[model samples]
Target: MTGARTPCINPRCRRTFKADGGSDEVVCGKCFRTLAEAVRSEHRRYWREIRKWDRRILRTADNLKVTRMAAIRDRLSWQLALHWDAEIKPRLIAPDKPESLDAFLEEVGL
Candidate 1:
């Protein structure tokens, strides 16, 4: 209440708050914390799902005989690729390389 006021950049939370006049922050502290947590949660969820597929692939590979290994690996690879492209890629800010949570939140306009 004592400094320059600015509205949170997050569309869902546009509450105005006092900010340092020279600060570059667009989102308020509350919205930034929430968005950061959400990004972390989503990142954990994505990796958990991917790990499930990885475990399945490992198990399938272990159980398959040498003669059928190639086909199984190909099928598993395709399944993972399909899941990523369909379910995960669209939600991510950058799928190619890992990015900081802040970057991810900013990229998604949160």
Candidate 2:
């Protein structure tokens, strides 16, 4: 027998899907896969940007006093947190996705 029909939970894709009797999924298979891929891509991009910043910070640290280096590290941490909260947090849709960039990097073994 065909399962009950339900609409995808993704606001951008509300296409109706057959709800499996044994599953509680709220999104269509296609949308779920697409969202998963998008999240992965975003994670990679965020990591790359973080590495670039790390390289720059290290280069600058060589010529800076200990106090100035600490300040730079603090500023970089604040900026990265702000970007993750304002930009990356909203796009995360996967149920098992990491809630923070640090967690993501850890998950990927980077």
Candidate 3:
């Protein structure tokens, strides 16, 4: 009954640490800040990737109408949803995106 392990977020460290809230699991606010910074740093790229996925889905709309491809489309959409939840959504906006990412967008006049 071992718990989960997460990689140490220190940029200079290569070790993994337990992250499952065990009694001995030490928490690190610095790592949390680091993770958030990394996510925010790529906000624009994340949006671009999400838009690309949208266009790809639209292009495949006709194939989805073919009945047999319906299953494949469903599977793809499910996978996409998982990706969105796990990767894409967290980096786009606050309380998701950090202030720096939003400021970056503003600077670009977006």
Candidate 4:
């Protein structure tokens, strides 16, 4: 099939190979260098956007005179953790899909 190849694991490497559907220990030379990178990319994207939202969250949380930044951070962190576990993790399996950070923020009502 046209879409069956996986990208190389090495950040500097540009390679793609067919998925052999074999054991985890089995990896092509290039993918061995960059395994699970898409997952990392997703987390980075989420956190970057969350930092932007956190500025607003803090301002809104502050205007009401909330004294617990730690609590608010913790709660938002948990919400993001759940969002990643539930929504983002599921789609990582199909990395080629049309997923976007804005869509995730919208999904989480951020």
Ranking by lDDT: 2, 1, 4, 3
Worst 10 residues of 4 by lDDT: 23-32
Count residue pairs with overlapping backbones in model 3: 1
Best by lDDT: 2
Model 4: per-residue Cα lDDT at residue 89: 38
What TM-score does structure 3 among the candidates reach? 0.27
Q: Which regions of candidate 2 deviate over 4 angstroms?
A: 1-64, 93-110
Show model 4 residue runs off by greater than 4 Å. 1-67, 94-110
lDDT of 3: 0.51
Error of 1 at 95 (Å): 12
Q: What TM-score would every model get versus the actual structure?
A: 0.28, 0.31, 0.27, 0.30
Candidate 3 lDDT over 20-99, as tens digits, reads: 57533222445445445555345434456556655565667565454544555555566655654565444322233346
- Tens digit of lDDT per residue, candidate 4, span 1-110? 67566654333445566666752222244433343666557656667765866676666745554445445656667776886565453443334424799878877999
Clashes of each: 0, 0, 1, 4
Q: Per-residue CA lDDT of candidate 1, range 1-110, in tens?
A: 46767765555565786666754435455643543465546545655665665556566645455336555546655665565455443433233435889879988999
Task: Return the candidate ranking by TM-score, descending.
Answer: 2, 4, 1, 3
Candidate 3 — which residues are off by over 4 angstroms? Answer: 1-65, 93-110
* Tens-digit per-residue lDDT, 1-110, candidate 2: 47677766556665876665654435455654554465546645655665766667666656565456556656666665665455444553434554899888988999
Error of 3 at 59 (Å): 12
Please give the lDDT score at residue 86 for candidate 1.
56
